[model samples]
Target: MNNSFGLTHIVQFFLFVALQVLLMDNLVLYSTGFCFIYVAFLLYLPLTINRVWLLILGFIVGFTVDIFYDTMGIHAAASVLLAFLRPHVLNLLTPRDGYDSSDAVNIHVMGTRWFLTYAFTLILFHHTAVFFLETINSQTFLYTLVKVLISTLFTGIVVIIMQLLFFSPKRERIDYR
Candidate 1:
């Protein structure tokens, strides 16, 4: 990545984290699904990013959110898991045409179906890890399950909307070769 790319990501990192802590965190739906839009940073990372760097970035983003939320390590842990699993998730969803390492993973590039599946899978993984760890002591598995599902749906919807509105891709075809 060039210096500008790195700087752009740095700016985005702070922007997303601030949004998560300042705004999204305050918007609670039915006292359940909390929006963790910060994960969008991790989700939209360049496909060629080093795994180690990705993990570290995920940790930084999550830990930043955790500090503000006063829930030490919960966000960090889930974020690390998301980062660790990202490559695998993308690999599993790779289109028959294949992926270009230079391209960003957004709805505009991957189409709506692929983007939805990719985003939902990662969001579900993230929310599951977060809710389960935070509610591990609780006896109600069903309640935890419901929270994870609702939160995943809410987060996924917001992510898709954001991509459609602001990050929509340019019109161009990606060659598998």
Candidate 2:
């Protein structure tokens, strides 16, 4: 990536973290759950980005969030895991040689069904890892499962909305060749 692209990514990363810490973290829907729209940063990274850089970026983003939430390293661990798994997940959803770096994974690029599946799978992975580590001692599988589901749903919705509202593709058809 060029310097401009790197700078843009960094700025977006901070904005996502700020949104997560300042806005989403405070908007509790229930007693013990809240949305985390910040994960969208990892989701929207260019498909062609280096895996190592992605993982590093994930750790930085998660650690920043951890600093804000005072939750130790849970977010960092989960974010790194999500970043590592992203390429695999995208590969599974997209055909060989069909990936498009210019496009963000969304309903417009991947179609609704694929986008929904992709988003939910990644969100669930992130939430599961986060809540599992958060509730390490209790081992309440059912409660953790519920939390993961609810939080993933809320976060996924917010991610989709933000992508639709703020992020726009260049409107050129990707040449899969």
Model 2 per-residue lDDT tens digits across residues 29-136:
784566877788888777777899999989999899999899999999999989989889888888566865566555677676877778889889999999999988
Name model 2 segments beyond 4 Å from true.
169-177
lDDT of 1 by residue, 1-177 (tens): 677777778998998998998899789899888889999999988877899999999999999989998997999999999999999998998889788765677788788998898899999999999999998866878888988999999999999999888774663333222
lDDT values of the candidates?
A: 0.88, 0.81
Q: List the residue pairs that clash in candidate 1.
A: none
Best by TM-score: 1
Q: C-alpha displacement of 129 in model 2, angstroms?
A: 0.8
lDDT of model 2, residue 126: 91
